[model samples]
Target: MIWILSIMMIIGIIIFLDTWRGIQTVLPLSAVEPLANDEKVSVIIAARNEEKSVEMTMLSLLNQTHSELELIVVNDRSTDATGLIINKLARRHERMVPIHIETLPSGWLGKNHALYKGYQVASGSFLLFADADIHFEKDTISKALTYMKAQTVDHVTIAPDLQAKGFWLQAFISYFLYGFSVFKRPWTANHDHSRKGGMGIGAFNLIKRDVYEQIGTHEGIKNRPDDDLKLGQVIKQNGYKQRFLSGVNQLWVEWYPSLKEAIKGLEKNTFAGFNYSLAVTVFAITTILISHFLPIFTLFSTDYAVQLLSAIFLIIFLALYGVTIVKMSSYSLWKLVVYPITTTIFLYSTIRAVALTYIKGGIEWRGTFYSLKELRGKQHQ
Candidate 1:
């Protein structure tokens, strides 16, 4: 009876997660068409060992159909020749402004510091914070800016096309982005734009200059995951309007190099979100096991009816996963066959993130070792 109750609960929760996924934000996510007068914009590229993608990003930004713009690339003390690449781009394009990071004060996190540094030199009314890995169409930025202006949104962000190159990389990233975003209701991010709200990825975000300072931008969650869902919340909670666009055709970002790279990246902030509390951590783990793994238990049961029901539910989950992938990116329908494999990676990453974030001090990013506790304290800093 107890086992039956658990299975029923899991089924109910899965249904709820899937339904909530439909409640998307009603923002202006029209197709990417060039804005009539969308100029007077600046692009800020933050990099540290991004030599591979920096040049392409510059060329992409330069080719944008917008006029009267400045592209500032801040090389954050990269040991690689990332700076040289930036300088080369600047030399080739008169509008490109390649700036070396002067020095970051002790309190600031690296990306936030680099971004703030870039903002210092920007003279445009609108500012774009794009990752070094992202590539966009000629009209992408202009179209996005026009939509923001038309809707009067202080901040606008589009979910980038998650380009998965490896099998496991495809498995894990698709689950986290498409599956998780669908489940987490990231589209309706503004409703809970506080510490309790969903986060915005810094990659491919366009914001008004005034609103950036009003909410303190990354300053609110600087010590935590600078990329934590806080930026959206900060904008929403502070009374600035914001929206998430589903423009898969217009923008794309390569999240990481390999599955190992992806794991290390998520490890840093898995615990960073939980305030490092023991009780919340335990609850989270238990919830994940129940909601995601309980169906596997159906195999050991003798009841034919229960087994059949569980199988049906699992198949429904696979369909949803496939729908998510195709909607968010250009993955084929046959990829749905790998749902179980993908979901397992998602479960494992969350569990691994919890263990490493709590048992070990904190996961490493670049070279910084920011502890979970240190991150929470730094939020107020």
Candidate 2:
């Protein structure tokens, strides 16, 4: 028991250190200077039933510091007032151009198709594919453009400051992001070119127009459910320079309203991210449980040495989570006290994702269903 606990502690410490190192590599947008070039930038958004958030997202883009910018929003066959809201906004703001999609074509996901349509008409030197739920601060785009120019990189993605409400939701995001940092390792996205290690945040993916054209644009990743990450991977795999930035004070988005909503929200991507592999899904659930929950429970064991080691491991684990929360702009330190609850919720969600995938026989997104066979055999762009 003692040996097993010691090995777990060692593995925990190694992952903690590696995650901290990766967090440090994500440069904040505040450190970047304003753009010096007068290049034209096109901001593309794919909206489907985003009536509640589209206005704010559109207005944020309109308020950018950069003058040479165009906002192209493709309404992806919305059933609500999304198109009406966009049209009203477009009439008021010259920069906002709304394209209504009456129907979705074959051989493409809804959002990916919308993005592709927008990309075809984009006449900018730089293109930024942003989600309608994302709220950008005044200088966010300017800072991103400047950073790209300074780093001499063709592609860049900014991890948004996630706004997760309630205790369970906050903790879930913290654990989820910690795992993302450990596995995706956003730090190595630019530094290591030998491996395809780039990360693309759904909130923002800014790329050079020519680079997008070179990589075959959205057509390359048209069928991929995890388009943002896949696009970044394609960029890295193609020998292009790409960087991931921290969007602490610059870009923001409300990830989910509650813990239940998050669990359902991530169900599709969780299984899809693992390429619909049952083995990988099981491995992920096991990994989350052993890494997070095991140490805390082991602290209450009879052996004094085991308890002491468990306590040490738990503290290190909290520290690792703390770094992740701070980097993600999650200021609720009190949530750490109830870390065990969040850990349990995260584990449950992982299992739920797997079960949901099996029960539904496929992934359902935006009223579209994709089978397990289709997801497993998904071709990379």
Candidate 3:
């Protein structure tokens, strides 16, 4: 009983700290700049098998209110009509260019190589490495540039507004976002000058051309799954300033269509996030269960003090999750009740990611199989 209470207190403290940090750190999006900056901005998109969404993403980006812009779409060997769509769009839009990648080198991961290829030909003072599925509002780039200009940072990663349709999807995202805030502690990414903590997002990672070139770009993080995160680490390690902001109204992405897809989607990178170590995965799952899921069951305990404490902790946890939910999506506090389901599902996915990696001896993503040894090797700084 004492041990359980101790854990409960720790969990409550963490929730309080995480919520406070999020409220303090997440920046708000502003209106579109009435006047565009003269500095040329190059937007890079590395796409593969994104047939259904690539066209819309490209159109949104091309229609940005920013005047001096170059959009480079790298067709990373998509089996669908991604290449054809890029070609068609490039023909119509003078600023859009398409680069088809027919082959990938031995040491490079698909997305990393594709981004690197796009970077090679990019000619702009600033570079925006955005995802193919993300749809940017006309003012996203404008607002990003404005924010960058206002601050002394060299790189900015925006946590885009997530577009989740169904209830389960929203609930899942609520838990995911809260957990990320608690664990990732994005606020510290910029505050810590030790060059160790970094934060980045695929939705909108804008960097100056000089800073990117100095850090070796994607070449430094080749063959890694979470290239966005590693890029932040590299930038910070190189002693460059980076900022994270909220893009609720400026940018959005349809993260996953269904619950099953969401689970499967997490399988690729969840364990990889733990550096492919079974020990870390096990420890993580255990901690998650104890610190997050266990509180609910304690509410039914006959011990009055335990029940009271459990209820208090649960309320605090829901409140913390609600703060992040409001930040990430259009969901309300009502959805916070399903956080346990979200944590359970995420734990299953993490275990599945580990099992798949060990059983297949490698991880398969977008028609490419990366060996476990290779992935483990690249996990180090």
For each candidate, what is the lDDT? Answer: 0.71, 0.84, 0.83
**Model 1 misplaced regions, further than 4 Å:** 1-30, 190-199, 378-381
* Model 3 RMSD vs true structure: 1.7
Question: 6-102 in candidate 3: lDDT tens per residue?
Answer: 6777768776875687567777765435356888999999999999999999999989988899999999999999999999999999999899999
Off by over 4 Å in 3: 31-35, 192-194
TM-score of each: 0.87, 0.95, 0.95
**In candidate 2, what are the lDDT values of residues 33-80, reduced to their tens digit?**
785568899999999999989999999999999899999999998999
Candidate 2 Cα errors over 4 Å, as ranges: none
**lDDT digits (tens) for residues 1-381 of candidate 1:** 346644665675576465446433533344645567734888888898888898887888999877867999999878898999999878888899888874666656677778778888899888888888888877888788888778777788777777868777876777776545554566565553443444466667788888887777566656656563667656666666777777676777788889888877878766655666668777766765655567668745698766776666566666656656666666666666676677677667777987876676765666656665566574532
Q: What ranking emerges by lDDT with the best candidate at the front?
A: 2, 3, 1
Residue 187 CA error for candidate 3 (Å)? 2.1
TM-score of model number 1: 0.87
Which of 1 and 3 is the better model by lDDT?
3
**Model 1: which residue pairs collide?**
193-233, 199-229
